[model samples]
Target: MTKPVIVVPKGMEFIRDEIGYAPAVLANGTLYIAGQIGRDDSRQLVTDKEAQFVQVFENMKRVLAKAGGDFDNLVEMTSYHTDMRDLPLFMQVRDRYMKGVLVAWTAIGAAQLCGAPGYFLEVKAVARID
Candidate 1:
Protein backbone atom coordinates (compact mmCIF):
# COMPACT_ATOMS: atom_id res chain seq x y z
CA MET A 1 0.00 0.00 0.00
CA THR A 2 1.28 3.45 -0.85
CA LYS A 3 1.55 5.78 2.09
CA PRO A 4 0.00 9.23 2.06
CA VAL A 5 2.29 12.19 1.55
CA ILE A 6 1.39 15.34 3.43
CA VAL A 7 1.62 18.47 1.30
CA VAL A 8 1.86 21.74 3.23
CA PRO A 9 2.99 24.68 1.25
CA LYS A 10 5.20 27.40 2.65
CA GLY A 11 3.31 29.93 4.78
CA MET A 12 0.79 27.22 5.64
CA GLU A 13 2.85 25.57 8.32
CA PHE A 14 0.68 27.12 10.98
CA ILE A 15 -2.21 24.99 9.84
CA ARG A 16 -0.27 21.83 10.59
CA ASP A 17 1.52 23.12 13.62
CA GLU A 18 -1.03 25.28 15.37
CA ILE A 19 -4.21 24.04 13.76
CA GLY A 20 -3.04 20.42 13.71
CA TYR A 21 -4.31 19.43 10.27
CA ALA A 22 -2.62 18.85 6.99
CA PRO A 23 -3.49 21.23 4.18
CA ALA A 24 -3.51 18.35 1.73
CA VAL A 25 -2.77 14.67 1.56
CA LEU A 26 -1.57 12.85 -1.55
CA ALA A 27 -2.07 9.13 -1.88
CA ASN A 28 -2.39 6.81 -4.84
CA GLY A 29 -1.95 9.74 -7.21
CA THR A 30 -4.89 11.50 -5.66
CA LEU A 31 -4.55 14.74 -3.79
CA TYR A 32 -7.13 15.71 -1.22
CA ILE A 33 -6.90 19.41 -0.49
CA ALA A 34 -8.41 20.71 2.69
CA GLY A 35 -10.98 23.47 2.70
CA GLN A 36 -9.39 26.87 2.29
CA ILE A 37 -10.87 30.12 3.58
CA GLY A 38 -10.36 33.64 2.27
CA ARG A 39 -7.30 34.33 4.35
CA ASP A 40 -4.61 36.64 3.11
CA ASP A 41 -0.85 36.11 3.20
CA SER A 42 -0.77 37.03 6.87
CA ARG A 43 -3.66 34.65 7.53
CA GLN A 44 -6.13 37.47 8.01
CA LEU A 45 -9.64 36.72 6.74
CA VAL A 46 -10.34 38.81 3.66
CA THR A 47 -12.93 41.55 3.91
CA ASP A 48 -14.74 41.84 0.56
CA LYS A 49 -16.49 39.22 -1.55
CA GLU A 50 -14.51 39.44 -4.78
CA ALA A 51 -11.09 39.74 -3.14
CA GLN A 52 -11.98 37.08 -0.67
CA PHE A 53 -12.85 34.70 -3.48
CA VAL A 54 -9.53 35.42 -5.14
CA GLN A 55 -7.63 34.71 -1.94
CA VAL A 56 -9.48 31.45 -1.45
CA PHE A 57 -8.52 30.27 -4.93
CA GLU A 58 -4.95 31.45 -4.42
CA ASN A 59 -4.78 29.46 -1.22
CA MET A 60 -6.14 26.41 -3.03
CA LYS A 61 -3.59 26.90 -5.78
CA ARG A 62 -0.79 26.83 -3.26
CA VAL A 63 -1.86 23.45 -2.03
CA LEU A 64 -2.44 22.18 -5.58
CA ALA A 65 0.93 23.38 -6.74
CA LYS A 66 2.63 21.87 -3.74
CA ALA A 67 0.92 18.58 -4.53
CA GLY A 68 2.17 18.65 -8.13
CA GLY A 69 -1.00 19.75 -9.85
CA ASP A 70 -2.82 22.83 -11.06
CA PHE A 71 -6.43 23.94 -11.29
CA ASP A 72 -6.79 21.73 -14.39
CA ASN A 73 -5.98 18.69 -12.31
CA LEU A 74 -8.86 19.22 -9.99
CA VAL A 75 -11.39 16.40 -10.28
CA GLU A 76 -13.91 17.56 -7.74
CA MET A 77 -14.68 20.67 -5.73
CA THR A 78 -17.07 21.62 -2.96
CA SER A 79 -17.74 25.15 -1.82
CA TYR A 80 -19.60 26.17 1.30
CA HIS A 81 -21.13 29.60 1.22
CA THR A 82 -22.64 31.67 3.94
CA ASP A 83 -24.86 33.41 1.41
CA MET A 84 -26.11 31.95 -1.85
CA ARG A 85 -26.54 35.43 -3.31
CA ASP A 86 -22.75 35.72 -3.50
CA LEU A 87 -22.59 32.83 -5.96
CA PRO A 88 -22.39 35.11 -8.93
CA LEU A 89 -19.25 36.85 -7.72
CA PHE A 90 -17.76 33.61 -6.57
CA MET A 91 -18.30 32.03 -9.97
CA GLN A 92 -16.62 34.96 -11.64
CA VAL A 93 -13.55 34.55 -9.47
CA ARG A 94 -13.57 30.79 -9.81
CA ASP A 95 -13.78 30.99 -13.58
CA ARG A 96 -10.71 33.19 -13.71
CA TYR A 97 -8.55 30.33 -12.49
CA MET A 98 -10.48 27.23 -13.51
CA LYS A 99 -10.97 28.62 -16.99
CA GLY A 100 -11.17 25.61 -19.40
CA VAL A 101 -10.91 23.00 -16.70
CA LEU A 102 -14.13 21.16 -16.09
CA VAL A 103 -14.45 19.71 -12.65
CA ALA A 104 -17.41 18.40 -10.73
CA TRP A 105 -18.52 21.20 -8.41
CA THR A 106 -21.11 21.52 -5.70
CA ALA A 107 -22.01 24.81 -4.08
CA ILE A 108 -23.84 24.53 -0.83
CA GLY A 109 -25.32 27.23 1.35
CA ALA A 110 -24.44 26.81 4.99
CA ALA A 111 -25.26 28.56 8.22
CA GLN A 112 -21.58 29.18 8.81
CA LEU A 113 -18.16 28.00 7.69
CA CYS A 114 -14.86 27.16 9.35
CA GLY A 115 -16.64 27.66 12.64
CA ALA A 116 -16.02 31.33 12.12
CA PRO A 117 -18.05 34.35 11.20
CA GLY A 118 -17.11 37.01 8.62
CA TYR A 119 -15.77 34.38 6.23
CA PHE A 120 -18.09 34.12 3.28
CA LEU A 121 -16.69 31.02 1.64
CA GLU A 122 -14.64 27.92 2.03
CA VAL A 123 -13.42 25.75 -0.84
CA LYS A 124 -12.36 22.13 -0.60
CA ALA A 125 -11.24 19.93 -3.46
CA VAL A 126 -9.74 16.74 -4.82
CA ALA A 127 -7.19 16.56 -7.58
CA ARG A 128 -5.51 13.88 -9.66
CA ILE A 129 -1.75 14.13 -9.53
CA ASP A 130 -0.50 12.37 -12.61
Candidate 2:
Protein backbone atom coordinates (compact mmCIF):
# COMPACT_ATOMS: atom_id res chain seq x y z
CA MET A 1 0.00 0.00 0.00
CA THR A 2 1.23 3.49 -0.88
CA LYS A 3 0.21 6.41 1.32
CA PRO A 4 1.05 10.03 0.61
CA VAL A 5 2.46 12.07 3.44
CA ILE A 6 2.50 15.84 3.98
CA VAL A 7 5.92 17.23 4.77
CA VAL A 8 6.36 20.58 6.52
CA PRO A 9 9.80 21.53 7.80
CA LYS A 10 10.82 23.07 11.13
CA GLY A 11 11.91 26.66 11.93
CA MET A 12 8.82 27.87 10.11
CA GLU A 13 7.03 29.17 13.17
CA PHE A 14 5.46 31.98 11.18
CA ILE A 15 3.80 29.66 8.68
CA ARG A 16 2.59 27.31 11.35
CA ASP A 17 1.23 30.14 13.51
CA GLU A 18 1.40 33.82 12.72
CA ILE A 19 1.10 33.53 8.93
CA GLY A 20 -1.15 30.51 9.17
CA TYR A 21 0.21 29.01 5.96
CA ALA A 22 2.83 26.57 4.78
CA PRO A 23 6.10 27.97 3.60
CA ALA A 24 6.68 25.32 0.96
CA VAL A 25 5.02 22.11 -0.08
CA LEU A 26 6.93 19.48 -1.97
CA ALA A 27 4.83 17.37 -4.24
CA ASN A 28 5.58 15.75 -7.58
CA GLY A 29 9.15 17.03 -7.35
CA THR A 30 8.20 20.70 -7.05
CA LEU A 31 8.34 23.17 -4.17
CA TYR A 32 5.83 26.04 -3.95
CA ILE A 33 6.86 28.80 -1.59
CA ALA A 34 4.41 31.22 -0.05
CA GLY A 35 4.62 34.99 -0.11
CA GLN A 36 7.09 36.54 2.36
CA ILE A 37 7.16 39.99 3.92
CA GLY A 38 10.01 42.21 5.10
CA ARG A 39 9.79 40.90 8.63
CA ASP A 40 13.01 39.66 10.23
CA ASP A 41 13.71 36.46 12.17
CA SER A 42 11.86 37.99 15.10
CA ARG A 43 8.89 38.71 12.82
CA GLN A 44 9.37 42.43 13.31
CA LEU A 45 8.64 44.57 10.26
CA VAL A 46 11.35 46.74 8.77
CA THR A 47 9.72 50.07 7.89
CA ASP A 48 12.37 52.03 6.05
CA LYS A 49 12.45 51.77 2.28
CA GLU A 50 15.99 50.48 1.82
CA ALA A 51 15.99 48.68 5.15
CA GLN A 52 12.69 47.03 4.43
CA PHE A 53 13.78 46.01 0.97
CA VAL A 54 16.87 44.31 2.36
CA GLN A 55 14.90 42.66 5.11
CA VAL A 56 12.30 41.55 2.61
CA PHE A 57 14.86 39.59 0.62
CA GLU A 58 16.57 38.38 3.76
CA ASN A 59 13.30 37.14 5.14
CA MET A 60 12.61 35.39 1.89
CA LYS A 61 16.05 33.87 1.94
CA ARG A 62 15.58 32.49 5.44
CA VAL A 63 12.29 30.86 4.56
CA LEU A 64 13.67 29.51 1.32
CA ALA A 65 16.71 28.12 3.05
CA LYS A 66 14.47 26.42 5.56
CA ALA A 67 12.70 24.79 2.62
CA GLY A 68 16.01 23.92 0.90
CA GLY A 69 15.67 26.59 -1.80
CA ASP A 70 17.75 29.59 -2.80
CA PHE A 71 17.82 32.69 -4.93
CA ASP A 72 19.19 30.73 -7.87
CA ASN A 73 16.18 28.47 -7.60
CA LEU A 74 13.74 31.38 -7.74
CA VAL A 75 11.78 31.81 -10.92
CA GLU A 76 9.45 34.65 -10.00
CA MET A 77 8.90 37.45 -7.48
CA THR A 78 6.15 39.90 -6.55
CA SER A 79 6.95 43.11 -4.72
CA TYR A 80 4.65 45.62 -3.04
CA HIS A 81 5.66 49.10 -2.07
CA THR A 82 3.82 51.80 -0.19
CA ASP A 83 5.44 54.44 -2.38
CA MET A 84 6.62 54.26 -5.95
CA ARG A 85 9.22 56.93 -5.37
CA ASP A 86 11.35 54.35 -3.60
CA LEU A 87 11.47 52.19 -6.72
CA PRO A 88 15.04 53.13 -7.56
CA LEU A 89 16.40 52.13 -4.17
CA PHE A 90 14.30 49.00 -4.22
CA MET A 91 15.68 48.02 -7.60
CA GLN A 92 19.19 48.70 -6.46
CA VAL A 93 18.83 46.45 -3.43
CA ARG A 94 16.92 43.82 -5.42
CA ASP A 95 19.65 43.59 -8.00
CA ARG A 96 22.26 43.18 -5.33
CA TYR A 97 20.45 40.15 -3.99
CA MET A 98 19.36 38.79 -7.38
CA LYS A 99 22.89 38.69 -8.75
CA GLY A 100 21.51 39.55 -12.22
CA VAL A 101 19.56 36.35 -12.75
CA LEU A 102 16.81 38.59 -14.11
CA VAL A 103 14.02 36.42 -12.88
CA ALA A 104 10.40 37.37 -13.54
CA TRP A 105 9.25 40.19 -11.26
CA THR A 106 6.20 42.34 -10.59
CA ALA A 107 6.41 45.56 -8.61
CA ILE A 108 3.31 47.36 -7.39
CA GLY A 109 2.48 50.33 -5.18
CA ALA A 110 0.08 50.43 -2.27
CA ALA A 111 -1.20 53.12 0.09
CA GLN A 112 -0.07 51.22 3.19
CA LEU A 113 0.98 47.92 4.75
CA CYS A 114 -0.05 46.01 7.85
CA GLY A 115 2.55 47.30 10.30
CA ALA A 116 4.11 50.27 11.92
CA PRO A 117 4.98 53.50 10.12
CA GLY A 118 7.23 53.58 7.03
CA TYR A 119 6.92 49.96 5.97
CA PHE A 120 7.61 50.66 2.32
CA LEU A 121 8.15 47.24 0.84
CA GLU A 122 6.78 43.72 0.81
CA VAL A 123 8.00 40.80 -1.30
CA LYS A 124 6.95 37.29 -2.18
CA ALA A 125 8.73 34.73 -4.28
CA VAL A 126 8.31 31.45 -6.11
CA ALA A 127 11.18 29.05 -6.52
CA ARG A 128 11.48 25.72 -8.28
CA ILE A 129 13.30 22.62 -7.11
CA ASP A 130 13.91 19.35 -8.85
Candidate 3:
Protein backbone atom coordinates (compact mmCIF):
# COMPACT_ATOMS: atom_id res chain seq x y z
CA MET A 1 0.00 0.00 0.00
CA THR A 2 1.20 3.50 -0.80
CA LYS A 3 1.85 5.82 2.09
CA PRO A 4 -0.30 8.90 2.55
CA VAL A 5 1.09 12.18 1.24
CA ILE A 6 0.40 15.33 3.14
CA VAL A 7 -0.81 18.07 0.81
CA VAL A 8 0.12 21.63 1.61
CA PRO A 9 -0.65 24.05 -1.15
CA LYS A 10 1.88 26.74 -1.99
CA GLY A 11 1.03 30.24 -0.76
CA MET A 12 -1.66 28.88 1.54
CA GLU A 13 -1.25 29.80 5.19
CA PHE A 14 -3.02 27.27 7.36
CA ILE A 15 -1.90 27.02 11.01
CA ARG A 16 -1.14 23.32 10.77
CA ASP A 17 1.79 23.53 13.15
CA GLU A 18 -0.35 24.97 15.90
CA ILE A 19 -3.36 22.84 14.96
CA GLY A 20 -1.37 19.60 14.74
CA TYR A 21 -2.96 18.43 11.49
CA ALA A 22 -2.32 18.48 7.82
CA PRO A 23 -4.84 20.36 5.71
CA ALA A 24 -5.15 17.44 3.32
CA VAL A 25 -3.85 13.95 2.81
CA LEU A 26 -3.64 11.95 -0.39
CA ALA A 27 -3.60 8.18 -0.32
CA ASN A 28 -4.60 5.46 -2.75
CA GLY A 29 -6.03 7.88 -5.28
CA THR A 30 -8.19 9.53 -2.67
CA LEU A 31 -7.70 12.92 -1.09
CA TYR A 32 -9.08 13.59 2.35
CA ILE A 33 -9.27 17.26 3.25
CA ALA A 34 -9.52 18.77 6.69
CA GLY A 35 -12.27 21.19 7.54
CA GLN A 36 -11.59 24.52 5.86
CA ILE A 37 -12.75 27.83 7.22
CA GLY A 38 -12.98 31.35 5.74
CA ARG A 39 -9.51 32.49 6.61
CA ASP A 40 -7.63 34.03 3.70
CA ASP A 41 -4.03 33.57 2.61
CA SER A 42 -2.99 36.10 5.23
CA ARG A 43 -4.85 34.07 7.88
CA GLN A 44 -7.39 36.79 8.53
CA LEU A 45 -11.02 35.79 8.82
CA VAL A 46 -13.28 37.22 6.16
CA THR A 47 -16.09 39.23 7.63
CA ASP A 48 -18.76 38.97 4.98
CA LYS A 49 -20.87 35.86 5.03
CA GLU A 50 -21.06 35.34 1.28
CA ALA A 51 -17.41 36.08 0.85
CA GLN A 52 -16.56 33.77 3.67
CA PHE A 53 -18.47 30.98 1.95
CA VAL A 54 -16.51 31.62 -1.21
CA GLN A 55 -13.25 31.66 0.71
CA VAL A 56 -14.08 28.30 2.26
CA PHE A 57 -14.48 26.71 -1.14
CA GLU A 58 -11.44 28.49 -2.51
CA ASN A 59 -9.38 27.14 0.36
CA MET A 60 -10.58 23.62 -0.41
CA LYS A 61 -9.83 24.21 -4.06
CA ARG A 62 -6.22 24.96 -3.23
CA VAL A 63 -5.86 21.72 -1.30
CA LEU A 64 -7.55 19.77 -4.07
CA ALA A 65 -5.34 21.33 -6.69
CA LYS A 66 -2.28 20.40 -4.68
CA ALA A 67 -3.54 16.83 -4.86
CA GLY A 68 -3.93 17.16 -8.64
CA GLY A 69 -7.71 17.32 -8.46
CA ASP A 70 -10.49 19.79 -8.97
CA PHE A 71 -14.10 20.32 -8.07
CA ASP A 72 -15.19 17.49 -10.36
CA ASN A 73 -12.97 15.16 -8.39
CA LEU A 74 -14.84 15.78 -5.17
CA VAL A 75 -16.84 12.73 -4.12
CA GLU A 76 -18.12 13.75 -0.72
CA MET A 77 -18.45 16.81 1.47
CA THR A 78 -19.66 17.63 4.96
CA SER A 79 -20.29 21.19 6.00
CA TYR A 80 -21.03 22.77 9.35
CA HIS A 81 -22.88 26.06 9.52
CA THR A 82 -23.50 28.23 12.52
CA ASP A 83 -26.83 29.37 11.17
CA MET A 84 -29.21 27.21 9.18
CA ARG A 85 -30.86 30.25 7.70
CA ASP A 86 -27.73 31.01 5.71
CA LEU A 87 -28.14 27.88 3.60
CA PRO A 88 -29.69 29.74 0.70
CA LEU A 89 -26.87 32.24 0.51
CA PHE A 90 -24.31 29.54 0.97
CA MET A 91 -25.82 27.47 -1.84
CA GLN A 92 -25.69 30.43 -4.18
CA VAL A 93 -21.98 30.90 -3.61
CA ARG A 94 -21.35 27.16 -3.64
CA ASP A 95 -23.03 26.67 -7.01
CA ARG A 96 -20.86 29.38 -8.45
CA TYR A 97 -17.69 27.71 -7.33
CA MET A 98 -18.78 24.09 -7.90
CA LYS A 99 -20.11 24.93 -11.38
CA GLY A 100 -22.24 21.78 -11.59
CA VAL A 101 -19.62 19.52 -10.06
CA LEU A 102 -21.93 17.48 -7.87
CA VAL A 103 -20.89 15.50 -4.82
CA ALA A 104 -22.54 13.74 -1.90
CA TRP A 105 -23.00 16.42 0.73
CA THR A 106 -24.23 16.70 4.28
CA ALA A 107 -24.88 20.03 5.95
CA ILE A 108 -25.04 20.33 9.69
CA GLY A 109 -26.23 23.25 11.77
CA ALA A 110 -24.02 24.05 14.71
CA ALA A 111 -24.30 26.45 17.56
CA GLN A 112 -20.76 27.60 16.99
CA LEU A 113 -17.49 26.57 15.42
CA CYS A 114 -14.08 26.17 17.00
CA GLY A 115 -13.06 29.69 15.96
CA ALA A 116 -16.33 31.27 16.76
CA PRO A 117 -17.26 34.99 16.78
CA GLY A 118 -15.61 35.11 13.36
CA TYR A 119 -16.00 31.79 11.59
CA PHE A 120 -19.50 31.03 10.43
CA LEU A 121 -18.96 27.82 8.52
CA GLU A 122 -16.54 25.02 7.88
CA VAL A 123 -16.32 22.41 5.14
CA LYS A 124 -14.49 19.11 4.87
CA ALA A 125 -14.24 17.14 1.63
CA VAL A 126 -13.10 13.91 0.02
CA ALA A 127 -12.02 13.61 -3.58
CA ARG A 128 -10.89 10.94 -6.00
CA ILE A 129 -7.74 11.60 -7.95
CA ASP A 130 -6.37 9.76 -10.90
Candidate 4:
Protein backbone atom coordinates (compact mmCIF):
# COMPACT_ATOMS: atom_id res chain seq x y z
CA MET A 1 0.00 0.00 0.00
CA THR A 2 1.14 3.55 -0.79
CA LYS A 3 0.48 6.72 1.13
CA PRO A 4 -1.56 9.35 -0.64
CA VAL A 5 0.56 12.44 -1.18
CA ILE A 6 -0.54 15.98 -0.46
CA VAL A 7 0.51 18.62 -2.96
CA VAL A 8 0.83 21.82 -1.02
CA PRO A 9 1.37 24.83 -3.27
CA LYS A 10 4.25 27.26 -3.08
CA GLY A 11 4.46 31.00 -2.08
CA MET A 12 2.54 30.35 1.14
CA GLU A 13 4.56 31.74 3.99
CA PHE A 14 6.00 29.71 6.84
CA ILE A 15 6.14 32.10 9.75
CA ARG A 16 7.77 30.22 12.57
CA ASP A 17 7.49 33.14 14.97
CA GLU A 18 3.80 33.44 14.27
CA ILE A 19 1.36 30.50 14.44
CA GLY A 20 3.97 27.99 13.16
CA TYR A 21 1.91 26.79 10.18
CA ALA A 22 1.83 27.13 6.44
CA PRO A 23 -0.65 29.58 5.02
CA ALA A 24 -2.39 27.07 2.77
CA VAL A 25 -2.25 23.48 1.53
CA LEU A 26 -3.76 21.32 -1.19
CA ALA A 27 -4.61 17.64 -1.01
CA ASN A 28 -7.06 15.46 -2.96
CA GLY A 29 -8.66 18.38 -4.78
CA THR A 30 -9.35 20.21 -1.55
CA LEU A 31 -7.53 23.35 -0.49
CA TYR A 32 -7.25 24.16 3.20
CA ILE A 33 -6.33 27.76 3.76
CA ALA A 34 -5.15 29.19 7.03
CA GLY A 35 -7.07 31.94 8.74
CA GLN A 36 -6.53 35.14 6.78
CA ILE A 37 -6.84 38.34 8.72
CA GLY A 38 -7.48 41.83 7.41
CA ARG A 39 -4.05 42.17 5.91
CA ASP A 40 -2.43 42.83 2.59
CA ASP A 41 0.29 40.87 0.81
CA SER A 42 2.83 42.47 3.12
CA ARG A 43 1.00 41.10 6.18
CA GLN A 44 0.19 44.58 7.49
CA LEU A 45 -3.19 44.71 9.21
CA VAL A 46 -5.97 46.76 7.66
CA THR A 47 -7.46 48.87 10.42
CA ASP A 48 -10.78 50.03 9.10
CA LYS A 49 -13.54 47.47 9.59
CA GLU A 50 -15.16 47.98 6.19
CA ALA A 51 -11.85 48.15 4.35
CA GLN A 52 -10.40 45.37 6.41
CA PHE A 53 -13.25 43.02 5.54
CA VAL A 54 -12.71 43.62 1.83
CA GLN A 55 -9.01 43.16 2.22
CA VAL A 56 -9.53 39.92 4.08
CA PHE A 57 -11.73 38.50 1.31
CA GLU A 58 -9.22 39.63 -1.29
CA ASN A 59 -6.44 37.90 0.59
CA MET A 60 -8.50 34.69 0.72
CA LYS A 61 -9.13 34.86 -3.02
CA ARG A 62 -5.44 35.24 -3.72
CA VAL A 63 -4.51 32.24 -1.63
CA LEU A 64 -7.26 30.16 -3.27
CA ALA A 65 -5.99 31.19 -6.68
CA LYS A 66 -2.52 30.03 -5.74
CA ALA A 67 -4.07 26.70 -4.78
CA GLY A 68 -5.77 26.44 -8.21
CA GLY A 69 -9.17 27.35 -6.77
CA ASP A 70 -11.61 30.24 -7.00
CA PHE A 71 -14.56 31.82 -5.30
CA ASP A 72 -16.99 29.58 -7.19
CA ASN A 73 -15.21 26.55 -5.73
CA LEU A 74 -15.47 27.75 -2.16
CA VAL A 75 -17.69 25.40 -0.11
CA GLU A 76 -17.35 26.92 3.35
CA MET A 77 -16.27 30.21 4.86
CA THR A 78 -15.72 30.69 8.58
CA SER A 79 -15.30 34.11 10.10
CA TYR A 80 -14.05 34.98 13.56
CA HIS A 81 -14.77 38.53 14.48
CA THR A 82 -13.66 40.47 17.50
CA ASP A 83 -16.67 42.77 17.50
CA MET A 84 -20.12 41.27 17.10
CA ARG A 85 -21.51 44.63 16.07
CA ASP A 86 -19.30 44.55 13.00
CA LEU A 87 -21.33 41.74 11.46
CA PRO A 88 -23.13 44.12 9.17
CA LEU A 89 -19.84 45.63 8.09
CA PHE A 90 -18.50 42.20 7.33
CA MET A 91 -21.54 41.35 5.24
CA GLN A 92 -21.39 44.65 3.40
CA VAL A 93 -17.87 43.89 2.33
CA ARG A 94 -18.63 40.25 1.61
CA ASP A 95 -21.52 41.18 -0.66
CA ARG A 96 -19.19 43.39 -2.68
CA TYR A 97 -16.72 40.57 -3.11
CA MET A 98 -19.12 37.62 -3.49
CA LYS A 99 -20.97 39.10 -6.45
CA GLY A 100 -23.76 36.50 -6.00
CA VAL A 101 -21.48 33.51 -5.51
CA LEU A 102 -23.14 31.81 -2.59
CA VAL A 103 -21.34 29.59 -0.12
CA ALA A 104 -21.85 28.27 3.41
CA TRP A 105 -20.91 30.97 5.94
CA THR A 106 -20.43 30.90 9.68
CA ALA A 107 -19.70 33.93 11.82
CA ILE A 108 -18.51 33.74 15.37
CA GLY A 109 -17.62 36.36 17.95
CA ALA A 110 -14.33 36.32 19.77
CA ALA A 111 -12.70 38.46 22.46
CA GLN A 112 -9.65 39.56 20.50
CA LEU A 113 -7.30 38.70 17.66
CA CYS A 114 -3.53 38.45 17.14
CA GLY A 115 -3.10 41.89 15.65
CA ALA A 116 -2.88 45.31 17.18
CA PRO A 117 -5.85 47.65 17.66
CA GLY A 118 -7.64 44.31 17.72
CA TYR A 119 -7.70 43.34 14.07
CA PHE A 120 -11.37 42.82 13.31
CA LEU A 121 -11.39 39.36 11.74
CA GLU A 122 -9.72 36.18 10.66
CA VAL A 123 -11.23 34.01 7.94
CA LYS A 124 -10.73 30.35 7.12
CA ALA A 125 -12.11 28.83 3.96
CA VAL A 126 -12.40 25.39 2.38
CA ALA A 127 -12.49 25.29 -1.40
CA ARG A 128 -12.77 22.60 -4.05
CA ILE A 129 -10.51 22.45 -7.04
CA ASP A 130 -10.47 20.96 -10.52
Clashing pairs in 2: none
> Tens-digit lDDT track for model 1 on 1-130?
6999999999999999999999999999999999999998798989888899999999999999998899999999999999999999999999999999989999999999888789899999999998
- Arrange candidates, best TM-score first: 1, 3, 4, 2
Better of 2 and 4 by lDDT: 4
Each model's lDDT: 0.94, 0.70, 0.89, 0.76
TM-scores, all candidates, are 0.97, 0.79, 0.94, 0.83
Residue pairs clashing, model 4: none
On TM-score, the stronger of 1 and 3 is 1
Q: For all the candidates, what are their Cα RMSDs to the real structure?
A: 0.8, 3.2, 1.2, 2.9
Q: Residue 25 lDDT in model 3?
A: 90
Residue-level lDDT of model 4, residues 1-130, one tens digit each, is 3332333334335442354766676777777777887776666777777888888888887787776677888888999998889888888888877778888899998888874665889899888887
- For candidate 1, the C-alpha RMSD (Å) to the true structure equals 0.8
lDDT for each residue of candidate 2 in 1-130, tens digit (9 for 90 to 100): 2332233445556566786667666555455666556766666776565787888777677666766777888887888878888889988998888886777889888887765566777777767765
Model 4 misplacement above 4 A: 1-19
- Candidate 1 residue pairs in backbone clash: none
Candidate 1, residue 93: the lDDT equals 94
What lDDT tens digits, residue by residue, belong to model 3 across residues 64-124? Answer: 9888989999999999999989999989988987998899999999888874687899999
Q: Model 3 clash pairs? A: none
